[model samples]
Target: MSFFTSNRFQDRQAAAAEARKAMAEKFLSRPKYDPNDPAVKEREAKRRAVLEARAAREVERERRRAEAAAAEAARLAAEEAARIEAVRQEALARDAAENARRAEEERLEYERKLDRDARYAARKERKKKAKSPFERYR
Candidate 1:
């Protein structure tokens, strides 16, 4: 003998169908109806509204964060440009200083050469004017 005709199974199945129909009708209604003095349900609705608003606020916060990141990136780029310019200026100054040092060294070398040439010329003239030893003795 099967338990298919049990009274308990029939009652449970009927109750389940009724519950399903009620749920379906509630979902299909356009303007939802809340019974008068619906404090508990009102609180639940308010809670859901607050949760949705919080989600919107989070989206706005993310947008602002992205904008701030972009601004920061721009500022960093400008700073890097300034840093590169400063380095270029420093390199130019170093090159100028090196050139000046080289010029000064060349000037000093030329002056030393001129002094040596003058001394050599004066010694040659003295040798040419001096009398011979034999002439002096005679």
Candidate 2:
């Protein structure tokens, strides 16, 4: 290493070769994987167990989600049914109110008709009494 290098390309190529050799030596010094090793077999078993546990947890989570969805759907259905029932009840109440109002109007109209007829009959009776006895015979 120097503060500066006269040949930059040579310095770069040497550094690259040294790095490659170091990497190769590091890989070669490490213990190689042997399928028959007890430690390797134990690690594989542990990894398989962990993978199985993760799969079971995922399945459980999915099942819970489905149950929650079903519950939510039932709640929404109940709310909708209640809303429809309320609307039906309100409509029935409105119909009943309308019927009562119509009946009241009819009753008032009949009363007015009766009053008019009574007034006309009284005026006819007075006129008949005012007439002479001979006029009544004629």
Candidate 3:
């Protein structure tokens, strides 16, 4: 005894073929798409608008980033210039102090030399006057 009345191999093959044809007919019965449909045009327009908005936003973001980078570079350059100026001023001040010290030393040395020469001249004049009045007649 079997569950099906006609459990023959030919009967099973015929039933399977009918089922496949029915499935293919069902798949082919749906309406085809039309490119000229208003709904499709509206969807495409919406997608284009979204893409444009996204591109505008990206351009604005890039502009802001470039401005920020330029500002940072300017700030760093200003800081470096200030630092260099400070170093230059300090060096000039140190050189001025050294020159002043040198000038003072040279002035003191000149005065000492002058004083020694004057003392030697006065002693020679005194020795010459002590013997000159009598030695001239001889």
Candidate 4:
């Protein structure tokens, strides 16, 4: 038989026997991993660190964006409130000025009526006096 054929038969039979023995073993054993392999544990650690840094940076960026949005909303609310307050104050001032003007006009009309009534009463009394004394003498 050729060397390769002889080796393949032997390897297969041995592999079968080993698999059966492993199944019958009381406790299973884990395969040995190389601790000192150049691209093994170091590469995994670097990849994990990169993922963690990216996660932290994303969280920080989201927090800043949220803060900026909140500040902008607050500023807009304050501006709207100030504008409403200014409008209210202007309306109140206008109402007060109109009330004062109306009151002054009513006072002037009352004074004119009182003066006209007094003049009319005095003229009637003078006419009565002149007629009474002169007609009796004649």
Each model's lDDT comes to 0.92, 0.96, 0.93, 0.87
lDDT of 3: 0.93
Q: In terms of TM-score, which candidate is strongest?
A: 2
Off by over 4 Å in 2: 1-7, 30-32, 132-138
* Tens digits of per-residue lDDT for model 1, 56-112: 999999999999999999999999999999999999999999999999999999999
Give candidate 4's total backbone clashes.
Answer: 0
- The true-versus-predicted C-alpha distance at residue 82 of model 2, in Å, is 1.0
Model 4, global lDDT: 0.87
Instruction: Provide TM-scores for the models.
Output: 0.60, 0.79, 0.56, 0.55
Residue lDDT tens for model 3, 1-138? 688587899999999999999999999996577778898889899999999999999999999999999999999999999999999999999999999999999999999999999999999988877767678789
Show how many residue pairs clash in every candidate, following the order shown.
0, 0, 0, 0
Ordered by lDDT, highest first, the candidates read 2, 3, 1, 4
RMSD of 4: 11.3
Q: Write the per-residue lDDT of candidate 2 for residues 1-138, one digit (tens) a residue.
A: 666647688888999999999999999998899999999999999999999999999999999999999999999999999999999999999999999999999999999999999999999999878979888799
The candidates, ranked best first by TM-score, are 2, 1, 3, 4
- Lowest summed lDDT across 10 adjacent residues in model 4 is found at 24-33
